[model samples]
Every structure is written in structure tokens, then in C-alpha cells.
Target: MGQMRLDTDPIVQVDRKPKCCFFFFSPKIQANRIVRAQLWVHLRPTEEATTVFLQISRLTPVTDGGRHIRIRSLKIDVNAGATSWQSIDVKQVLAVWLRQPETNWGIEINAFDAKGNDLAVTSVEAGEDGLLPFMEVKISEGPKRIRRDSGLDCDENSSESRCCRYPLTVDFEDFGWDWIIAPKRYKANYCSGECDFMHLQKYPHTHLVNKANPRGTAGPCCTPTKMSPINMLYFNGKEQIIYGKIPSMVVDRCGCS
Candidate 1:
């Protein structure tokens, strides 16, 4: 059995706006010796109706290898006036444990209101050397919209407005990774006949119009159509590009599922 070192101790806090806490580990311990790991979170209730939510996963470098670290076990608990800290165990068998490449490890914890509105988020990392390093990520209050140029206008006589377009871009820096758009239309939306939603279907493509909704379908009045392809370039310690059709037709959705 290998030794486990905790870089940060568990603590509790209360916030009106809701924020997640973080703990970080140092990279001084042996990597291969670690057979399994676990995290214990102590949630101290500040209000009568307070509730807490949590999530744990591994974070790998983009350039290292396209491998996902398997978490053997995950536990969740909700308690009223609970004094003890909740324990989350992450363990794996030999083949499952060794399948993942040796890299930095990270876990993400989230809390939400009764209505499912995000209240807080916390993150912790375990380095290859067995040192646990942590960083806290604060969630924004609401949805954010980003725009970029989509060059697909055919009206050369309609002034510069005919040639200018805007596309959306999202940055996942809070998760310690970054990706960019690629030319592909894995999803689709309804728009004027002149708008070429299909052009964005291929790689190295861009949006054609600014007002055009990439999610617009031609059927119902407000039904969500398909979406454009988004090239994801992951930036861990190095740059890794994933060029493929998104599994689903939704936009801005994350996670392997």
C-alpha cells in the first residue's frame, strides 16, 4: 500500500452569494505508488433550508494522452444540522487504475439552491508527486453570450453588412483547459434561405450571418434546430485538437456524456 498525503484540511464556510472553496496539493510525492485517493468535505449549514452538492473527477493534461482517469467510487450525502464531514471515496482496481496516464488530478465540487440555481463551486488537484494543490472556481450569475465573425453573405451590393457575421466562442479557463472553434457543422439552425448553415458543416468554416440563430430549425415556430460544429482545442500544459462531430445537437454543453 502507498501513503496518501493531504495538502489541505477540510473546512466549512457560508456565503450569501454562494461560492465554492478550493484546496491544492504539491507535486513532490511519488505518482505510480498511489493506488487510490479520496476526498472528505465538511459542509457546515448556515441556514435551516441549506443544502449542498458535490462532484469529483480527474484532470489530465491535454498534450499527454487522450485518457480519462476512472473514479472507482463516488458518494453524496445531504444532511440537516450535520456536524460530521462527508467522505467521498475514489478508488480503483489494478487494471482500471493503471489505465490512466500519470498526470495532475483534479476534483470539482458544486452547490446549488433548491430551485437548482448554482450557488457555489470548489476544486482541488493532486499533482503527480502526491501533493494536493487546489483552486476555486466562481460561477457567473447568468448565461453569457460571445460573438465572432461568420463570413457567408452572398449580397455583394448590400454594403458591408452583407459580409459581416458573428459567431459564438466560449472559454473554459475556469477548468484549466481551453478550446477553440473549428470548421464543422455537427449542429444546425434555421435561417433565411440566403444563409448557408450547411457551409459551416465542414472543417475550417465560420458563421455566415450575425442575426442567424445556429439553433434555428425550419419546423415549429420556436423549436430548437441543429447547431454548428465547434472545433475544441484543449489547452492543458500543451495544445490538443479534437476534430469530430459533437455527440449531441446542443450548444455550450460540457462533460463526456
Candidate 2:
């Protein structure tokens, strides 16, 4: 129905050697409209990336570890302004994801050169039209499903009498922001250093863990200097989203049981 923007840090030279950005989005299907399945956005590369890997994946639950399955990917040589505005063809993947219930999906933007590693940072600003990442979708009419189906229009251009429905839908996010986290643990890994392996502040690892061997317990962490209650309260960083009520334990491992 509208656009959703997700932003990250501005610093490219993080404490970690390689700068990796993990972005997540959950698209919920609408009642009557058909999804066009395309994502358009502007990607600003802070530096030249001789070779880059842009991967889109889904997180699936596992017994011991949490991991993401690669759904779509791209490798290319990037110039600073060459790919500012690009369109990703996601028709096939969007259709598949829409069929399932709320699923975890993400974009991993990693850049490097033929010789080896490279550096880059996404331009994330605080306001709309800032460097924050965003996406847009188009909707058309469907067959069999009618106007009364989900109270939304499948085809804005059509006034058809008969419509159809199959279970195709998407959601940007579903509930689960009710609970709050103490600022201490969050500030500890403010830059998200090596803490991607643990569940802190009663929350799952904010990053997508390795599917083959997701770390089971919390590890020693360091809080950031900006640990304040007010700062933590207004922070809109979304790590994990739960479909129903907050789970008993911070998402016991990353994949579905």
C-alpha cells in the first residue's frame, strides 16, 4: 500500500574488517490486488566496488543454528554513481514468498574488488528521501477473487465483475514491537561487532546467523558509550518480528521449529 524504508549506520570503517550490511523486509500480501513483483530503489555506493555481491535470502528455522537460504543474488563491478538507481526483478521470489505466511527475508550488500576486499557504506539519513533504503511495488487485478475479498483493489485499472484468489500476499512486518529492551546490552554491541552470535537484551541475534551452526547461547559483550534509556526507547531498529504474542524466550534459535 505504501513505501517502507530501512536504514543503517553511516560509518563504513567499522571495528570489523569487512563492512557488511544486512537489511530485512517482510511484505504482506493484500486482499484483492496482484503484486507486480518488482523492487525499485536507489543504492549509493560510498566507494568503488570492483566486485560486489548483493544477495537476497530467507531465514529458515533450524534445530541448533539459524541460517538464511539464498533466494536471489547478483555479482557485479560497481562504480560510485553507476548504480544509484536500479530495479531488481523479484517477480518469481515475491510470488513464492507471498504464498507462505510471514517469512524472514533480507538483503546482504557486500562489496569487494578482484584483488580482494573493498569498503562501502549506505547513505542512511534520518528523514524521508534521505539515504535510507526503500522499495516500491505495483498492483494489478486478479481473477476469481472479488471486490469484497480483502477490502483492497487487485487491479486499480480494472472494474471487472469476477475475480479470483489463491494465497498470495506479503507484509512489511507483523507485530512484536510491544516488548522493550534495556539499553545496556544493545549499546554493548552498538556497532554489532562480534555479537551476531548471541541473544542479548531478551532478543534474538539482530543479524541473520549462520544456518549450519547458529550459536546457541549468549557470549560476553561490550556496551556502547551511548547507553541511555531515552535513546533506547525511541530507537526504531527492527531486528526480529514475531507473528503472534512475544514468544517465551527470545526466539529460541533463529529458524522455525
Candidate 3:
């Protein structure tokens, strides 16, 4: 999962005095992986309580002029003399933008049927801390495949080689991984040792397979039999913070299979 604040202040068109606010965001992730995206805005307190109908639309340019294509609209009952935060689901819109970045013209918010005090749209520059309009996005990478690189730890001085787990500390800093927020270094144990016929007996299927076809099949080697995930807080390619579990990061047990 990743999140990003609004990069620029929302554009307000006031020549015709239309109750509209246009916003744009650069989503740097795959459309299929996006879990959700939201547009957060602050609705200022009104003089009296009333229902406000708001239309959220995407801008589409045409030969003559651009048109506002309505995507989804929201209706909210404004509280008298009280300010509130409004969040609009824009997951679908973000998907389109991610797939076709060139079509990102922006979105517009149109408020209708409001008297006295109209809806107040806050901008990042004008609004107070945390009240500025922004977009919150979340993405999922789905199931990650197991790493296939060499994860075995061995010693040169050791004479005996048996299936065993070794302490291996993974330091992200050594790789210049500044994106990771926590666990600069962690214990990600590796497995290393020899696997002979005696140890292969632990796994009945592997032993039988090796015994039946010794010349045709390759010999079993020491590998991780049990592994656990690690909770990681890091930034994605878009520079957004993501907190999730990375599977098969720590080897718990080693075996010949």
C-alpha cells in the first residue's frame, strides 16, 4: 500500500463564478494493482443546515471546447456552523489515469442548490495543516514469488556439512535502500549444508524419488523447509509509504529435499 499528498493546489476557475474546483494528481502505479484511491477535501461550515448536491466529473477535450463528463456525484447534508472532511472514492478514475497517463486532464467538482454560504473548497496553500485537498491512494502487489537467488550461508573452515540454519543479518543500508522506513537491518536466516542419503530419508517422497532414479534425477540439496514473512514499511516506485508483509523472508528450518 502507498499514499501521496496533493502535489499542487487545486485550480479554481472564477471568471464565470461557477461553483467548481479542478484537481489533478500523478499516480505512479499499475492500474490493475491499485486497491483504492480517494479525493479528500474539507467542506467549510455553512450558515444553516442544508443538503448540497455535488457532481464530480472528468474533463474531456473536444474540437470546439472541453466538456465535463460526469463520473460520480456525491450528496451531503451540511451541518450548521460546523466544518467537516469529505472523502470521495476515485479508484476507478485513478485506474484510467494509470493506464493512460496522457488522458489525465483532471477532475472537477460542481456544487449545486446551495444558498447563502456556498461550499468552500480549500487548497493546499490556503488551507490549514491536514485540511488541504489531497489524494490518498493504496495499491497491492498481490502474491510475490519466492526469491530464487543463492540464499545459502557456508563457511570455508568447516569440515562437516549437514542441513543447518545460519544467522544472516540483512542490511538494507548496504544496498543503499533508503526507501525502507523500518528494519534497516534484520535477521533473515539462511540455510546451508550438505544433503546425503541419510538426511534425504527425512522426506519420504524425496528419498524414494532419488532412490528410484539416481542417474536421471538430480540429488537433493539443503534448503529451507520452513519460512516466515516479515512486516516491512517502505516506499514504492512512486515514493509512497507502504506497510505490508513480505513472505518467505526468514528461514526457520533447513532440510534435505
lDDT of 1 by residue, 1-257 (tens): 11222434333232222223223443432334444454544333433355555455443444544234444333334555443334455433222333533433333444443546433223333332211222211111233354232223223244432112222333344444324322212222222222233434431223323336667433212112333343232213322122244443333221110
C-alpha lDDT of all candidate models, in order: 0.34, 0.36, 0.65
Give the candidate number with the greatest TM-score: 3
**TM per prediction:** 0.28, 0.36, 0.49
Per-residue lDDT tens digits for candidate 3, residues 141-173, read 566555654344454565657767788899999
Candidate 2, residues 1-257: lDDT per residue as tens digits? 22223343322222323232333334544523544444333443445445665555444434323355666666665675454433456666555555654442333343344555433223444432333333333454245433331321223344432221112122212334333321112111111223333223333343223332466433434222221121221123342211122222111111110
Question: How many clashing residue pairs appear in each of the predictions shown?
Answer: 25, 28, 0
Taking all chains together, the TM-score of candidate 2 against the true structure is 0.36
Clashing pairs in 3: none
lDDT of the structure predicted as candidate 2: 0.36
Worst 10 residues of 2 by lDDT: 248-257
TM-score of 1: 0.28
